[model samples]
Target chain A: MALRFALMIDPLAADQTAPDLATTFTAVDPAAPALTVGELSTQRGDGIFESIGVVGGHPQEVEAHLERLVHSARLCDLPEPNVAQWRAAVAIAASECGEGEGVVKLILSRGVEHGPTPTAWATAATAADFSLARTEGIRVVTLDRGYAIDAPARAPWLLLGAKTLSYAVNMAALREAHRRDADDAVFLSSDGFVLEAPTASLILQRGDTFITPAPNGAILHGTTQLSLFEHLAARGFETAYETIPVDELRRADAAWLVSSVRLAAPIRQLDGADLTVDAEFTASLNDYLLSPRD
Target chain B: MALRFALMIDPLAADQTAPDLATTFTAVDPAAPALTVGELSTQRGDGIFESIGVVGGHPQEVEAHLERLVHSARLCDLPEPNVAQWRAAVAIAASECGEGEGVVKLILSRGVEHGPTPTAWATAATAADFSLARTEGIRVVTLDRGYAIDAPARAPWLLLGAKTLSYAVNMAALREAHRRDADDAVFLSSDGFVLEAPTASLILQRGDTFITPAPNGAILHGTTQLSLFEHLAARGFETAYETIPVDELRRADAAWLVSSVRLAAPIRQLDGADLTVDAEFTASLNDYLLSPRD
Candidate 1:
């Protein structure tokens, strides 16, 4: 699927007297240019973003995504985003988009040089069919993230927790995975612990219980993983966030790379080591992820 | 100082049958937008850039900057930039820019998703006056870059040497320096070696000799510093690149952070420790840096 819809959100339109936020969430032609060349989003990647998975015209976990957006803004030292304003924009984008699986992205840039206000916008795109991976599973290779898990707390300037637009390293890791003939990658900390994947969270399972790398300052607190854990706990299964060692990955009975759009992809192989796959369980998790949660 | 000129360069226009590269670069309104929300440059900070210093209507070190741009593109797995087309665009930008001191920024983004061509542009802005820092000098602080020196060699995917647009961490480092009451920050390798500043290169002076962190696959080979070394060597000053230890910074007779637009700023203070400033020597070096150099 291609892009289903796009909207240019006016983050500073609250003071306007226009009803229905008529000026706040305006429609934008998705194909046209909508950003200045000077935007720090492009110049310095000085921004934060959020991508909410939308299914059947229902945007999932709007509150959680918005909360994470604010969390990211705080970590990046950006001005706090107005959650109410953004929630409204996501609604408009979801309703306008095709009623199939999709994603809604919100961006808050530091705006143009010397400009008074920050640049804000939201765009919606229909997600590509992830049917094959969701069922067939994906092979993953472990790459070194080169940072000790403790690096984040020692140097907040690294912006480790913030989901800023500085994703070149992440993108590079993905390319390396493809070059290695793997479908995805899992990053390992320099101190010999398992970190998250480039764009998703890493979870290892044994029997019925599941364990994911704890949300240390170095790893992103994955939204999808959090929701999945809740779902798992409700189903009477044990779930946990633990500091997983490199050798522990080999000991796992099963594993997965989970995210909002891709839902859950069972890790069939890890650095040449094989893991068991529960096709029925993985399918049920995908079903839970694709439904509107909030 | 304000933005003086902007040009959108078509990197794929070689097939056009036009003269003066007229169809290649078109002047853009500095105040208007020129990018789409879907562009990877803004979405993922997926691009490379070069900033050339312009003095008295001459773009200094154009070749070096462009060469570095190509180097960065290759490191980031981006398409090799068309240097000839970029040089022409830079010339046009410099000619239209104001005299005195300024900067011309060149950006080559991965472009909009699913688009055939890459998005490229150049913009000129009059530089902010650095009279105080150039003469009076600046205070410095050291921050951890969180990567071991050997890590870069081990993991090319980290893109340590690439001048990528994913600069959120650099921006955060600068902000951290400000909060610490310092004028700038130098990144220290996790293994106790000096790296470089957020946007400038670090050079330590002792007696009449100077040393900068070697371009050892972990640091950007600073273009301005390279030019200054050539100039200094001509003046009978010994210049070398070495793996300087952290303690070596405190033992230096003097030090400076050098870059294109900022030229050279002597270090007056480092982490609250004082250092001597050589006004006459610094000014002459700036004079050399300001002149058109290829």
Candidate 2:
């Protein structure tokens, strides 16, 4: 079976030179595209973004994605992009999507023209490949130091949950994890609460309850995880938004990383600790994901 | 004399669509002068920017600006750009700069790319009119909501003192101040500390005691401020990096906004409250500004 992807990744064995991804993608058309870039970044560092998997010539759950995009933007105190324009742009980009499944990303920034104004926003889509997920569930690491979101004032400015452009720290944390010979990283709040894995959703099962961090101002409200909740609910699993303690998760029935690309990847081993319930939950979740979303 | 500017307002009325300031300036390159829209933006907003003003039309202080750029990039945790390439790009841009007391601005940004990764940054330069500073001192409003730099882990993430692309908040604050019928805005930290004015350097008072927020972590270290400090030392004024409360500033013997563009603008008011600082400091600072360094 051939894989479908939004991004085309040339295999390490392929001969052709990788395209200058940066320069080639910019539009020559000035007026609208100009507005798009600025508006997309309107929230300064208080916006949300999604990099999703487009499979079998269809961007799965696009409606759900757009819905979350709008919700995330509003929560971040940003003016919404015209939904029609957004849908059209995504559809136009999706139509030209090449062979195989790839990745499509959406960003909603503070739309502040001068970087501090906070007025406009822009959203653009790009297709890329991530077949790497199919072969290996990422080797994840944990940060010894954690983020502090202890105050209400801190809550408003703690842009981590909003997925804003102020992503340097988060990316830095991931890089630190990578440097430690880990594929990805999970952040713990300074008080030792398990926060999140960089750029993906979290779901841990303890008996019948599927638990993750509450999508309050402290955590990014992930669309993929919300969708998975529906399946968990129908299957008689109690879904929850309460904070799951690190100790509890390590002892949970099963744990999985849910994201658009690797729909449900089992947490094979976390920080060298083997998770016992990986296989059963991994198979069940994959079966549900392979079924049509109608 | 008729002023040459990219967007100068008519003093007589709101004639925003006046004839071109220069008949020779064109949208194209070479004999006809050209400027990118992004270049025009550096002058707008209380936009935090570094300019080692032009000398004989050649951009001086490239190293200083580059050093500050890297520092700003680090403060904002932005991906490092190729400094050598940037230097070469600015040199090429500087060569295109025509003479007559103008400044060359090196504006670094996330460029037009969207998503998790940023596209390459670009720099452009254009001639600026310095005559505006030779005449008028600016009017400014002081805002009391000061900057956030108290958090131990997060305070280091404050981009206050660096000239970064995320300047929309400053621009918006200026607009808010303008809407309140003020020319510009001065930022006051939450603790009543008198930080730097929106675009310019801090206002220090008396001969031996000048006050501005310590560049410890909260403010962009101003190149012009550094120059002023050097001259202040030579003139027997002891420049100290101590935090001055807003109440002390309101009662200061004198105050002025120092910057590359305004050079030295005497602060006539703090918010709507009046200031009694004499205009002589503006002249002395101006002298220090135009005087060639050894």
lDDT for position A64 in model 1:
83
Instruction: For model 1, state the Cα shift of residue B264 in Å.
Output: 0.1
Give residue A32's lDDT in candidate 1 (0 to 100). 77
Worst 10 residues of 2 chain A by lDDT: A1-10
Which candidate achieves the best DockQ against the true structure?
1
Angstrom error at residue A255, model 2: 4.7
Every candidate's DockQ is: 0.75, 0.08
The C-alpha interface RMSD of every prediction is 1.3, 10.4
Q: Tell me, by lDDT, which candidate is best.
A: 1
Worst 10 residues of 1 chain B by lDDT: B13-22
* Model 1 per-residue lDDT tens digits across residues A1-294: 355567877776754334566567667777777777888999998899888888998998888888989999998888888777888889888876586788888899977888746788888888888988989999999999999988998998898888899898999999999999999999998888999999999888978888999887898888899899999999999998889998999889989899878889999988887788889999999999987798
Candidate 2, residues B41-77, lDDT tens digits: the string is 2111111234556545566556767788777666545
Summarize candidate 1's per-residue lDDT along B180-258 as a digit string, tens digits. 9999999999988999999999999988899999998899989999999999999999999999998999899999999
